[model samples]
Target: MDSKTPYKANLIKQQKVCERNFHKLMKLLPDLENNDNLVLSFYLAGWEGQARFQVLERAPYTTVLHVNLDAAWGQWLKLPEFRIRIYRDVRMAEIISVNKDRHFKAIYPYPNEKMLMPDEKEQLNQLFSEWLNFCLTHGLNN
Candidate 1:
């Protein structure tokens, strides 16, 4: 097998994930043009949480959105937060920033100063997918 085979495979998988999450985000962003901010609440199945979405930048073919966990409970919880750049024409959404840091590499050297994992990029995208899935499945627009 070629050395690049694994990387190519991962890239393909990540693209699928991003594309799927884009559709999910679109579902959650209904009536998007009228409002800049939207919040969704989830309380069913003994789970309680909220997700806040804001449009940071809008363009003809691309949009940047900031998403975060909105905790009505308290401030002690560490929320999962990220900024997504959606390519409308391509139908893809990707995480540009996460955990308050704006820069992330596709791969990182282990035991580095920041301690980011090697697959940080893929992890962040996967995380965005999970969050989108959870919110769409459990959330109610508010």
Candidate 2:
């Protein structure tokens, strides 16, 4: 792995959780292949309130595919938030840059006081399904 990879450490920390979520989502989407066409990466960021999940294309910096999840919103929605907001923001911005630029700033919305509820697992799976479908449809992976 590249030493300068931005989210290497974060990805390592959340590998199991992210993989579990990804596998569940993949099972739901029969059309998506787990091989070359699709790639998945996950990371955790320490925003003021709590840690958030960041998902991005597992390609080099030249590829312009990425996403960022808002921990605050995830907490609010009781879902495992992972970069949906960032994806939407980038679509709105129409910036054609690769994933090299950190286009977002951290902010504290609320402290993470609640425990990891059981339902969050299902919610995370659902969210990942939506994201995977989006990626497959847009040809972002292949």
What are the Cα lDDT values of the candidates?
0.82, 0.34
Please identify model 1 stretches exceeding 4 Å from their true place: 1-9, 45-47, 72-76
Which pairs clash in model 2? 68-83, 69-83
How close to the true structure is residue 58 of candidate 2, measured as C-alpha lDDT? Answer: 35
Clashes of 2: 2
Q: Write the per-residue lDDT of candidate 1 for residues 1-142, one digit (tens) a residue.
A: 4444443337888889889988998898877666789888987557588888899999999889988887645367677788999899999999999877877777776657988766778888988888788888888898
Residue range 60-123, candidate 2, lDDT tens digits = 2222223443344465565333432212212111122212322321221222344332233333
Evaluate model 1: give its TM-score. Answer: 0.85
- Which numbered prediction scores highest in lDDT against the true structure? 1
| RMSD each, Å | 3.2, 15.5
